[model samples]
Target: MKTLTRKEFIEQVGIGAAVLFVAACAGSCKKTAQGPSSVNFTIDVSTGNLATNGGFLVQNGVVVARTSSGSFIAVAATCTHQGGTLNYSSGSNQFVCPLHGAIFSSTGAAVSGPTSTAVQKYNTTLTGNSLRVYS
Candidate 1:
């Protein structure tokens, strides 16, 4: 058996801590929607869940929501706090993550939740039956 000197012990501990930190950060290093790079898609609002207010659907990594007042808003579908899937709350006009109760505003700004990072927001334009979501 061998006993480590103070210097050796400190070096080993430091290395171990560095390894742990890297490992911990590796998960966060994954790509976030981060306003996505470029988003341009068309959704049919004449029918389906989008036809009425208080309805939402996820498309191309973005969640398209219709507010209670019949307004359209689009944001990243993933929660910034822990990458959980987000759901639209028409009553609160917010996005919520079921996994950790993280909340985000309709504009994708994290608020009163575990995360402070805001998700991506997309511009939307409605032309009759077609709703175009773009960056």
Candidate 2:
């Protein structure tokens, strides 16, 4: 067998490294681009009476009262996994993603995986009859 030159060996290794990098990036890029599906409308906050344990979907987010402590919290209704919108479950008092059954607490904590990230939180303040949520 003939001895391989240093330049030839370096060139082969470089080509192999480039192919590995491209394949790795291709797989991860698809995941990063994934997000919640879009909804065409927004929820009217004024109609959301904050009297009891009422929750409402305003625009693409949700405003909910976790307790009688007057603690109102807002979070994105969009799922972090495959871009599914979550519905407010008054019975369970949690956000339920219909797509894959992922659950989240009223405070946006991830109750389950399938989605390893928490729902995006929104800033909220009660403005008279309307709940103002920052975009």
Candidate 3:
């Protein structure tokens, strides 16, 4: 077997590394091309005086309040299966996506769906009357 020179071996390795890095970077960058980078926005519900089982969508994001229990939960309004916009529906105690009728409960549980994946949920904490959600 012919062994490669040290310089030749290093050159091949470097080229392979560069190719792998570029491939990895390309995959990560593809999602950004569709639009502006994914963004996170905050909702201020401290003053809403919401009733039991009340909920609202903030800047297209959904937050459900278990008013009788004074607890709140935040979930991404985007559907995981098809990326459709989801809305909180009081009639069903769940989030409903209009495009494909995907349903998720307030805790981001998949209630029913054309989808098997549930909505992405945020960490919510009640500081006084304010509900804060984070990654």
Per-model TM values vs. the true structure: 0.74, 0.54, 0.56
Q: How many backbone clashes does candidate 1 have?
A: 0
For model 3, how does the per-residue alpha-carbon lDDT over 1-135 read when each residue is reduced to its tens digit? 889999999999999999999998986743211111343444466555343455565454544444334566667767766878777776556778789888888777777878766666666766665566665
Give the range of the ten consecutive residues with the poorest summed lDDT in model 2.
Answer: 33-42
lDDT of 1: 0.90
Tens-place lDDT per residue, model 2, 33-95, is: 122234223233444454555555445444344343555666776788887888777666777
- Model 1 TM: 0.74
Q: Would you list the C-alpha lDDT of every candidate in the order shown?
A: 0.90, 0.64, 0.64
Better of 1 and 3 by lDDT: 1
Best by TM-score: 1
List RMSD in Å for every model shown.
6.4, 6.7, 8.4
lDDT of 1 by residue, 11-104 (tens): 9999999999999999886555465768999999989999999999999999999999999999989888778888999999999999999888
lDDT of 2: 0.64
User: What is the Cα-based TM-score of model 2?
Assistant: 0.54
